[model samples]
Each structure stands twice: as structure tokens, then as C-alpha cells.
Target: AILNSCEYGEGWATDTYEKALKDDAEYLTTEQQAMIKAQHALLKADHDKVKSMHDTLAEIA
Candidate 1:
């Protein structure tokens, strides 16, 4: 962004003057998103299992 500033103008990095025209967006690629989706289910299930165990212990106490 700094390198392109001269051609684009200063504050260009922060400029939302024309929001739809502003093109600097960042995100995971399709392949990265797919991998995360597969792993996320396992992670969420593990978290839910631990949470359930914690709740059971809390109830017993």
C-alpha cells in the first residue's frame, strides 16, 4: 500500500471515499476455508464435550 501510495495518493490505504470502489480486501482462499470448516467441526465437538463434563461436575458439586 505504501509503495502504491504515490500512484494512488496518500490516505489511499484508509480511504473509504468510494466504499464499493475500494478494492483492498483480505480473506482466506476457498481451499483454506474448506480446511478450516473440516477442522472446525472437530474443534467445536471437543469443546462441547468438555463443556458438558464441566456442567455435570458443577451439578454434582
Candidate 2:
């Protein structure tokens, strides 16, 4: 259940960021851009961690 929530949150954040980048980049303040980039980086890190966990579980099984 927690994993599902994380996946949903990540998907929503990714979609929102992509839309902002595609549709509003030119209008965004520098600080806003930096914040979005930081969010993206954190999301990517979470994804990588999940993938690593899956790989380790696969190896164990």
C-alpha cells in the first residue's frame, strides 16, 4: 500500500513537472525552476532505490 502510494505520488509529480517544463518554462522564475529540478532529482533517486530493491529481491529469490 505504501509502495502504491509512492508510485502514484511520483507519477503525479512527474506529470506536473513535465507540464510545467513544456508549457510554462519561459514564464517560471529561477527559484521555481530550481525547485522543480530538485523535485525531479529526488523522484529519480526514489525510482532508482525502488529498482535496486527489486533487483536485490529478484537475486534472493
Candidate 3:
């Protein structure tokens, strides 16, 4: 749900800004960019931890 919210927020931001410009360029505010970056970092950390656990389990099994 948290990831979904981030995705939805990104989509909304793109629609609200890019649609006005009619271009593929991003126009995120500083705060929006920071928020997205933080979310991505969290997701990456979670993924890395899960992968490490899976690898450890596989080694034991």
C-alpha cells in the first residue's frame, strides 16, 4: 500500500505537470523529488534485506 501510494502520487504529479506542458520532461518540485527519492531508497533497502534473507535460507536448506 505504501508503494502504491508513492506510485499514485508520482502519476498524479506527472499528470498535473507534464500534461500542462505537453512534453515528456519531469517538472517535480524539490519536495516532491525528495519524497520520491526517499520512497525509492526505502523500497531498495527492503528488497536488499529480503534478498539477503532468501540467500541465507537457501544456503541452509
Model number with the top lDDT: 2
Clashes of 1: 0
lDDT for residue 33 in candidate 3, whole number 0-100:
64
Q: After superposition, how far is residue 30 of candidate 3 from its true place, in Å?
A: 1.1
Clashes of each: 0, 0, 0
Using all chains and alpha carbons, the TM-scores for the candidates as numbered come to 0.53, 0.63, 0.55
C-alpha RMSD (angstroms) for model 3: 8.3
lDDT of model 1, residue 42 = 57
**Which is better, 1 or 2, measured by lDDT?**
2
Regions of model 1 farther than 4 Å from truth: 1-26
lDDT of 2 at 42: 86
| Model 2, residue 52: C-alpha shift (Å) | 0.7
Alpha-carbon local distance difference test for all models: 0.46, 0.77, 0.56
Model 2 residue 45 CA deviation (Å) reads 0.8
Model 3 lDDT tens row, 1-61: 4544555565565455444344422676667666666665565566556556656766897
lDDT for model 3, on a 0 to 1 scale?
0.56
Give candidates' CA RMSD values in order.
17.6, 2.5, 8.3
